[model samples]
Target: MTRALVIVDIQNDYFPGGAFPLVEPEAAAANAAEVLGAFRAAGEPVVHIQHVSADPEATFMRRGSHGDEIHELVAPAAGEIVLQKAHPNSFLGTHLESTLRDLGADEVVVLGMMSSMCVDATVRAASDLGFDVTVVHDACAAPDLEFGGTSIPGGAVHAAFMAALSDSYATVVPAARLAQTH
Candidate 1:
């Protein structure tokens, strides 16, 4: 079965010095680049998913803005599939499902920004769409949050999301293992 790596929402705004940056964005980008390199070296397919915020009030990823573009560290190669999405779920309101179907992919390994949001959304959507989804835990991150006067660490949210996706929604895996897979 053909396998594809879905790098979702590694956009400029999610990185440092952007409108809204996630925790450890640079490291996530670097890990994703490593994974992408491994996939390319093995002649595997990669789909770069971008999230464009339809609302200008959105802190980051506003459509038609530079922040919505994919990060420079991991630029899309010529002929690489680029799916633009308006929602947190890449498969919703986008051609992502059709693209994967066209590519004849059976498995999808997901890695990218906003671990608790977009990453989680994509994983669930992929699973519901019947693809064998494996989410790269270390290659995903989310912004810190505050609840009831307490600050929630990004790492905690990231871990929680990974845990949630592990058994039912999708298989949670590390980038190293993903690199070893087809």
Candidate 2:
């Protein structure tokens, strides 16, 4: 089975000094970069999914903004595919599915910023789309979120989402395990 690495939303906005920074963004980006290097070395296909907000009210990642660009740590090399997506699910309203099909990818390794959002959505969607999905737990990050009257810690949120995803949507693993697979 062919495997593809799908790096989702490793954008400047998720890092320090940018709007909507994520928890441990640097560490997550570093892990993602490691996975990217493994995939590149193995001659596997890599797809970088960039989230560009179309809503004017969006605080970060607005189209044409520097924050919307892919972060330097895990930036796509030439000949790599960079897909722009507006929705949290990368395949929605994007060419991601077609691109994956064209690349003959039957399994996909997913990682990136905002584990509770983009990563969560994309993994579930990828499963529904019939792709065997694997999420790199340490390669994704999420910021603290406030709900009702309580604040949920970012690490807790990330762990909960990853756990939930592993229950049905995708297989959750570490970057090291992914490298072993390749």
Number of the top TM-score candidate: 2
Candidate 1 positional error at 91, Å? 0.7
Residue 124 CA error for candidate 2 (Å)?
0.5
Q: Clashes in each model (backbone N, CA, C under 3 Å)?
A: 0, 0
Give the Cα RMSD of candidate 1.
Answer: 1.3
In the range 63-159, model 1's lDDT, one tens digit per residue, is 8888999998789999898888888899889888888888899889899988988898889989988999888888888999888999999988888
Q: Where in model 1 is the C-alpha error above 4 Å? A: none
Q: Taking the tens digit of each residue's C-alpha lDDT, what string does model 2 give over 1-182?
A: 99999999999998889988988999989999999999999999999999998898899999988899999999889999999999999999999999999999999999997899899999999999999999999999999999999999999999999999999989899988887866
Question: Poorest 10 consecutive residues of model 1 by lDDT?
Answer: 173-182
Against the true structure, what is each candidate's TM-score? Answer: 0.94, 0.97
Q: Over all chains combined, what TM-score does candidate 1 have?
A: 0.94
Q: What is the lDDT for 150 in model 2?
A: 98
